[model samples]
Target: MVTLIIATIPACELALSDVFASLPDIEIEAERIVKGEENAAMPLLWVRGVEPDDFEAACEADPTIDDLELLADFDEELLYRMQWFDRIGLLFQMLTNANATILEAVGESETWHLRLLYPSREHLSKTKTFCSEHGLSFSIDAIRNMDRDPSGRYGLTSIQYNALITAVDAGYFDVPREVTLDELAAEMNLSHQALSECLRRGTHVLIEDTVLIGAAEFNL
Candidate 1:
């Protein structure tokens, strides 16, 4: 059975550690990371609680971050395409060796919370062992089998699933758009950006699971 692994690692142990330290109050969330060759990938980052000038300057000064380009600028958030050139072993292992899918990756202050989906329990163990041998400080917080988890089967966390469901029920997807993200987030008691991320990730998972080969796996 497929397994979902919840783990935590200090930002210093992962990529962009300096950026996190420089912007201690900033919240960084990965949005659909694209894996590329030569241990480099451009990840869409949703950075919150910092001005564009400060964030860019910090990234420029950080040796780990290679490049950054602004994608969007919200009231209190900025989206950017970022490339980290060093300290990405854990991320590379999760994506390549473990063959895991990153469902959610959020970084705050000094710690990073990761949600990964592996093909089997053994795969997760191997990944864990690799981390231990390399002294990456990767710590497992929880594990769940897809068959046993209500929302795991669809490759989404409980919170992501709930956000998607609530949005649908509130007609957030109606033809004319009955509800805005802010209103829906207020109703759900989640921040505007939080709800937006949940909805985006949840919808992506839903499409990948139901519209793609995922439907064939379950015969829906």
Candidate 2:
């Protein structure tokens, strides 16, 4: 069966990393490819991040960036449409060459984290080899089989797995709720809101995988 893999690619090997290095104070929260392949010109990207004015200036001055336009503005982050001149072709090659599907990608301070689905382990091996051959730094952070998990059903992401296990161990789901949300959040070293969101999403996945799916199978 196909496996789900979460990988991290160092900023040093990515074109966006150069942009981020130039604007060290700015952080990118999310990114989406708006149009065209990664290698093509005028590839539109929708980006959300802090310091809109600085971001604009940095992109304009950066050699890697071809052009940029402001799409929207908000209190926390601004949205941008950007075009890249070069240095992104390798990423497209990595995905297409491996025949992998990207589930999600997020950029942080030093790296671009990606969740991908590969046909099999052999395909993943080939992709890693391709990266090494091309001087791209690729590291697999986590992997799980979609067909089976320790819970005996749908696989949970590393974060979701940890959140659910921690909640149970800390007695967050106890009859009287042995642990407060704040206490649980502190124990996990996460903000209360973040912890709550993780648990909510984890519980939803667990229920869907174990209870809902099982019930449906039994009926059929």
Candidate whose lDDT is highest:
1
| Candidate achieving the largest TM-score | 1
Query: What are the per-residue Cα lDDT tens digits for candidate 2 across 185-213?
Result: 89889999998998887677666444442
**Candidate 1 on 99-216: residue-level lDDT in tens?**
9998878888778877778999988987889888888798776665777647767768888878888888999999989999999999989999999998887887677554442121
TM-score of each: 0.69, 0.62
- Once model 1 is optimally superposed onto the true structure by TM-score, how far is the C-alpha of residue 7 displaced, in angstroms? 1.0
Clashing pairs in 2: none
For every candidate in turn, the CA RMSD to the true structure comes to 10.4, 10.7
- In model 2, which regions exceed 4 Å deviation? 34-38, 41-49, 148-154, 157-220
- Would you give me the overall lDDT of model 1? 0.79
lDDT by candidate, in order shown: 0.79, 0.65
